[model samples]
Target chain A: MTAQPQIELTNIDKHYGSFHALRDINLTIENGQFVALVGPSGCGKSTLLRSLAGLESISGGTMKIAGDVMNGVPPRKRDVAMVFQSYALYPHMSVLDNLTYSLRLKRRPKSEAEAAANEVAATTGLQKLLRRLPRELSGGQRQRVAMGRAIIRHPKAFLFDEPLSNLDAALRVHMRKEIRALHDRLRATSVYVTHDQIEAMTMADHVVVMREGVIEQQGAPLELYDRPANMFVAGFIGSPAMNFVDGTVDGSGTGARLALPDEPSIQIGKRLEPGRKITVGLRPEFLQLASGDEAALHLSVTTVESTGSTTYISSLGEPEIVVVVNGRTDVAAGDKIGLAIAPENVHAFDPETGKAI
Target chain B: MNRVISSFRDGKGFDIALVGAALLFLGIFAGLPLVYNVVMSFQAVDMFSLGTFARPFVGFDNYIAVFSEPIFWPVMRNTVVFVVASIGGQFVIGFGLALFFTLKFPGSTYLRGLFLVSWVMPGLVVGAIWNWILAGDFGVLNFALTGLGIIEDNIFWRSDTAFSLWAVIIANIWLGTSFNMILLSVGLASIPRDLYEAAALDGANGWQRFWTITLPMMRATIGAVISLGLIFTLQQFDLFAAITSGGPANSSNVAQYWAWDFSFRQYDFAKGATISVLMIALVMVASVIYVRSTRHEVRG
Candidate 1:
């Protein structure tokens, strides 16, 4: 949104002995942006977040925070705050003391520290529970205390490492919005790390999908959803992952024929070499049940699952196809069905590179 | 009968039986001797009454006489100094070693395990070894001290009245430091590593993290370690016997060694029991503190 970047990382690399944990990572985040680094476990999302916090030093890179080069700066000198997945609240200290620890460490006056703690506590809805120790609070309350401790510091950037992973499902959903709201209210630069793509899609203004320490794709939430750069991003970004079916370009060069038993042909929006091998990507929600004349592919139904509002139909064949239909459908197992999709909703990828075409 | 059998087979009766065995053993071996020592402190006992429980009631006469003895105040002062100094040295050095080991350089686990050697060695054997190291003329400590320019002379550690009690305290501290380090290492290890990360990100340097995070989290452990140190130091008699033998003119004499001397050598069983009764009272207070501390762990 602005010309000045708040955080910039260029040519970042990390190594633990012979293992390269992170490769040439280049990213720049603008001021007050809520960015989420999301991937599966062992993908180095959390490691990247920790590197930004200065908890783990980069093996080779130039890291800048607030326009200052911070390559060798220690975490305490970095002027950033982190909320751990374990909450990591001071277990022995009361809620008020936990919130005021940073202030007290600076040798601030007791009255000034308490006033700051009280203000943060009120903002976090922890006013009535200030005297209770961390062990006395429930999981959600401890989470709030962890956040309050971070908020009291007025840090330059807030780094969150899977902060909602410990909560129950309902509470995780609730805290997701709460954390995003807190980020908006403070307008603080935040870098959130989580393995759940839904949390990334729902909460972050910009989402960076990662795999094995490499950024596969990064853009606005809908931009990534509508146009993924690769198969990994296409499968990772959507709820019901995109389905890939092997296909070959038709003689017309603008249509493709699927490899199913019927060899049904569908229109593609681009021109390619005739008889070129490609992979067709179809989203579940975009596929529709078609009548005989407009049917592109015909398949037998394998199973039908419903959750009151949507019906999930799995087709019976090799390279299984799943279709999500809104409202209830009477589709049952062993029933034959026809499927169709518009040309624009369909995506194609090169079978070798797995990159979107 | 069926109900009783069933309780033992599938209920609380078996648990009670297991606990009852431990209580019975304690009653016979430990509790009886403690109660007998308290009782003997209140009665007049001689060689004729040594075999029997019955003795003439003295009504605090033994306590008053023992308190009035010429060596009593000096022995009490020596005991206090011995306990305080030994515990202080052990804790400070042990805590330093514990924090050092947490750096986890290569082979740290093996090196830390090696520190347990001093803790497992018999006290008398350790004291015997210290006796050689603490010899008047050819001692390693005196050599190091003089080499460091801390002292000029050999100092005659065992014979000099000023350093006689300190001689035993030095050995006792060496004997106890390893145990202190081991317990403290466990306490330090149990702390989550993320807490330090959180604190560092919250703008606490290493020193502030220790004072705020490490020290408060170690409350239960510190309480337990200090109280146990008190108990062990109060019961420390082997170092005195092996190193100084209460020295020339009773200079290094303490309560436990003095109690042994009165009971076995002087045959003044009443005075011995009186001194022991005082020690038992102190140890009881320490026991209460140890239990309370270990029970109330400040963990989330």
Candidate 2:
């Protein structure tokens, strides 16, 4: 038999007066799974995470942790710990006291609380800094203290609200690795929220892409990257974003050809009705620069940006196209380049609805 | 270095002129009077000799006499009592009101505005209003008490020394509380909301949060309010002048009124200047100690 979910949110809705902040969000996290909610600003990812931790009250719906309803339960009683973006370490408290504050409040024995705090501190490499106040610690050290506070709780679930966003780029990468290692060691169910796609791709077991208070798509990181459900997900999940060319279909059922606005017609694997305007989406990585004698669509190159590993080429058209070529090619501005796009890599969506067809 | 010196020389005259103007104002307004009072406090003079800069110097005889007088110690004691009671009551009640207004409550804004009305009223007006309310004969308080059958007859509020002090305290509490409330309310609002949230998540209950987080966060504001309140309460005069008028044989006489009695009522300017100089010294010492203690608290 399968283990029950450690936390479950059912049909949750949150409203700030007349403004709807979170829609009907239904989610479940099984034991030991790491779920990352990835979205743009104001997408309600942090709000949803706060609600699950009982930091925020939901306007409607039921939240359960370990099979018990959590409505009206304060954050302290929720048996979950959160690491905030700002760390929120008590400025007046020593690192040791900050880690043990919750345990003392729970009426645990003083020795037990101290031992647990020390253990977590040692694990986070903060044992030597236990007596130092938060203001004296570096930003990374403060972040570690925040994480230590969460770990000492032995909570049913862990919530992270952009915990790494405040750190410098190098520290953020280092901390992400540490967090992943900690999760593996603890095997604690965790829900993290972040807007950085790299973070979402690197750390998440399951990525839930949200937009405008609604979940656009949720799947394993690569699955969501490969098969985005709609235009928003297609654009949001990847760096450099998927390029779309507005076009119309020519033939029905089994023989659909996509007519580009400024280039040659292309054949699609799926059938489409004639005269239906559709958007053809292509990831930049799939568009290959072709030679002059090759049978490929011709375009004028607008700009080229070359990194060591890949070169990005922008083409001139009504809806401009960008292509990411592996290994630096000899492409520059005003260069005429031919491009070939694989049919399997193409995504067709209804232009008006922005939905995958 | 030479060029900088030349530039400094060019602007030195204007700077000196500004400094001279400021010094002249201070001499006329603050420094000269303080010097005159100090000199006068050491001299023996009556109202006729007050305008003369030259008077018979009595050394410390005036100070010795004032200290030896029978009414001097009692008036000082009364001033201390009135200041401590009034300022202490104002701090506690004003902080409570500020905290109450800080909460997300219905009609709190309107209530705050209404509370401020007493503070905005002139001190003399407040004293008159309270005097009418606390009067022994034809007073609203006595009438209400008699009508409720709680008392047998009129209570002489101003006649009893202890009751007069308490009555003055009540009026001052009403007038001064709003000042602290406004200042402390601003302080409370300036505290970041996330600190409270952090405290809550750290398992601190309301009282724990208040003592550990709220109080310490508002320490500067509390110190400022208390210090200013003490100073204002110590020098209070108009209320007493309007209401009790140091009535019933000097029973309600505070230091300010006692000094006024010597200077204005008896036309003894020398003794009054002596009392005024002593009051200034006492207030200065209190303020200095307060500043030092707060500085220590902040550093620690």
Candidate 3:
């Protein structure tokens, strides 16, 4: 939201021997922004976070934290605090001692260190449990202690490496809001790494999606959801993933004829060369059950799964397309379903480069 | 019979049987000897009564006489110095080596494995080797020290009263350092690598991290190592026999060697038993410490 960038990464590259772990990464995170780097495992999301934390040396890059170039700076000198995925609390130390470790290491007076620990413990709800060692605490409590340890430092930026990956499902969901709320309250610049796209979509102000050593897309979550720049981004961003069906533009140039499972042609908003090959992207949530003449595609249902709140129906087509319907659906296996989608909802990409058309 | 058979199949009877075997072995080999030693310390026994259990009871005669011996205080002092110096030297050097190898350059693990050679060697063989190394003249240690200009003369490590105790201390440290390094290495390895990362990110400098993170995390391990060191150094006798023989007017003589001399050479059985009782008492405290330390692991 401001002109000044809190963290800037330009032409970042990393190599582990001959393997290029990161390539040509350029990103700017503004002050107080909650940014999430998200991708599947081995996609270098965690590696990028560690590079920002200075845990892993970058092979090549100009990484700036708070406007200072940070190439050869060690982690201790970087002034950034990291919450490890393991929570990595000192097992021998009590929660209070864990929080005060950095302060005490600086040879601060005992009273001053305890006071600082007390303040951070109060915020993290660890005040009552300060005397308990990390082993005595539950998983969630240990995680809070890990964060409290980092928070007391008042760091330049907070780097979180999959901090919620250890928690149970319900707790993970709860901590998502808590972490985002903590970021908002402190207005701290945070770079969160996760493999879960939902966490990125819901918690981050901006989300960067990465694939093997490269950023595929980055923007506001919905901006990415609505206007993904490539086939990979379109398929990766949404739940149930975007369905890609091979299609060719109609002679009229404003429509596409799907090439599978006896489905008819669908309307497109953009003009393209007639009869050009493309990959048509359709989101499951945007599809509707059609009756009279508005049907975009007719699919033979292969499987129907329901969780009382939402139902997912998949077609028994060569390129299987799934539709998510609200509430329970009577749709079952072997049912022929007629589905309709709007023109604007249809995304097309060049089949060769996977680039958006 | 049926219940026992069923219990065996279910693990309960088998567990009891396993424990009973160990207890029986301990009672025969360890418990009987320890109790016999304690009983003998309070009795008067000559060569004629040595084979019999019943001997003339002398109350505290043996303990008092043993304490009153002119060599008693000196031998006790030597034992204390031996244990303290050997343990301290082993631990410091081992810790340094462990931390050094943690940097993990190529072949460091293999090099650490090679250090175990000293530990596995018979103490007599190691002492024999050290005999050559600590020779009064034409010794490697003296050669190195004079070459470094730290000492101008050969210094006669085995003969000189000042350095005679240290001759054994030096060998014991070498014998024990590898074991210490191995255990400390395990402790260091068990500590999660992420804790250091977290500490580094918490603004701890290299020295600060070592002092706070490495030292505190190693508390249980250090306690175990030190207690084991006490037990090992107390048990150290072959090196004394093989090296100085606690010689040159009993200058390097310690309690274990004195116990041996009283029992085998002087044939004063009660005095030997009395000296051994004192050592067992010391080792009991160390055993308690070792058990407690190993049981209470400081890990999440």
Give all TM-scores, in the order shown.
0.98, 0.88, 0.98
User: Judged by DockQ, which candidate is best?
Assistant: 1
Off by over 4 Å in 2: A107-115, A127-133, A249-262, A267-277, A292-295, B1-28, B35-40, B52-59, B141-154, B289-300
At residue A87, candidate 3 shows an lDDT of: 94
Ranking by DockQ: 1, 3, 2
True contacts kept of each: 0.90, 0.33, 0.88
Give the clashing residue pairs of candidate 2, or none.
none
Clashes of each: 0, 0, 0
Tens-digit lDDT string for candidate 2 (A1-357): 139999888999999999898999988888899999999999999999988877789999999999999988887677888898988776667899889988877779999999999899889999899999887889899999999998998889889999999899999999999999999999999999999988988998999999889988889999988888889989988878898877777655423344443546665557777778888888888888776655356778899998889888988676678899888988789987887776777888888889898
TM-score for model 1? 0.98
Taken over the whole model, the C-alpha lDDT of each candidate is: 0.92, 0.84, 0.92
Which is better, 1 or 2, measured by DockQ? 1
Over all chains combined, what TM-score does candidate 3 have?
Answer: 0.98
